[model samples]
Target: MTDRSPRASRAGLILVPLLLLAALTACGSENDPSPVAPTAASSSSDPADDTAATEPPADAEPAVTLVDPWVAAAPQGVTEAYGVLVNRSTQARTLVSVSSDVTDVVELHETVVVEGGQMLRPVDGLEVPPQDGLALLPGEDGITLVNVERPLEDGDEVALTLTFDDGSSLDVVAPVRG
Candidate 1:
């Protein structure tokens, strides 16, 4: 297990990208200039719906965005992806599954504090709150790639697609490091 957050990636090729992410997150974007949430449509008094949100208008922003996405380096076996999942839309989204280019099996996992220590358990889905988000941190909630086909090394990248319950999906390239 590895700490994939930028705070833990303090060395090697990983630090450059993680530090940039930290700086950008700390500084904030120039165009929108909101807090963690982006500047998008506000909540409306409509019945809760997730299907219709499958596709957004060309001008519309993404319902969810991954901030500083990254993974821990590993020669093989399992590795977890970490990032802040920010849901910009008013409706909540559930991350049902994850597909990876390097691994055939990617499962959603949640870390729970047991009597002895901590344990990683498989979960059906990870929910992202409306106009809020969820953090995929190591030893916590995240997606795990089982039996990676190739070595995941520092500065390498892994392509992942996050499919939501609403039929929406987001493609991300997460950096590999320690």
Candidate 2:
């Protein structure tokens, strides 16, 4: 007689999935050399859902989005990107880093009043409140692109990639303007 218990059945089901996952992971394409980041289960007990911070909940909305993205017109030297970072997710999002197609060096900056005058200073991150937004205004808070590679003429577009604290990134094209 074969002994088949509920626990034994559950164990077999779990083992099958694990084996299948292992096999699929090992079968990578020849051209694809990048590794996919692992996402662990969220330990939160929210009533809505439990998804990783890097991902939106079951509601299916993106965590953050860019609005009115544009780069300042510059002949060379330094310039900045202007945009409004809108947060639609339940949790707040923090912008940790920013990069552009025109320049290799980018930084988060804010205007600070000093004894001499108001000066631009570096900031670590910019937080977008839940269901709110943070605007990048000139002479206020923005992403500074130092040592621009070429001239940023009006109507030209630059590709911008913004990374958040959750390790999720969003890409957008910003048109050069005044």
Candidate 3:
């Protein structure tokens, strides 16, 4: 009879590699875990839960919202715009500059008591606090729109662009009011 022991040993050596290869291939198959489904307690059908999901996170980007923006009616020469700058973000922002098609020059101004007289002075920028607001009124403390192209009449809409230090800008068509 032929010596079968050596042949069997050789066959076993080949089968060992095949078995290891099968084991490795099995492990390499896609076995990603399924996403967890929302439970009844966390479902958004509840109004409170829906609101929580829609709210921005604590570290979300700063959101600057302009509310009730209006330009004062000017018979001639210069005037100013008024509004509430609401900052909903966690970080403070700066109002860098302002522009408008109705005027050639727009600048940020603040009122200061100088020698017991309140005067308007140009400021580089205005800081808007986080979760707070800044009011731009028609006074020495408000922003000044200089050299208006024409007299802004009541009920007219003027396009105003506000620039922030973060390179973001807001364009608003503010209504002209007294």
User: Evaluated with lDDT, which candidate comes out highest?
Assistant: 1
lDDT of 1 by residue, 1-178 (tens): 8658544542333344345445655664333344544234433434564333444445544677787799999989988899888776568999999999988999998888899999999999999887565778766788999999788999999999999999988999999986
Candidate 3 stretches greater than 4 Å from native: 1-62
> Whole-model Cα lDDT per candidate?
0.76, 0.75, 0.72
Angstrom error of the Cα, residue 93, model 1: value is 0.5
Clashing pairs in 2: none
**Candidates ranked by TM-score, best first?**
1, 2, 3
Q: Write the per-residue lDDT of candidate 3 for residues 17-47, one digit (tens) a residue.
A: 4455345445432221123465777675767
Error of 3 at 2 (Å): 99
Q: Which stretches of candidate 1 lie over 4 Å from their true place?
A: 1-55
Tens digit of per-residue lDDT, candidate 2, span 21-127: 34644665323223555344334467455335445334442467776788999999899998777775558889999988899999998878899778998999988
RMSD of every prediction: 9.3, 21.1, 29.6
Could you tell me how far off, in angstroms, the CA of residue 145 lies in candidate 1 after the best superposition? 0.4
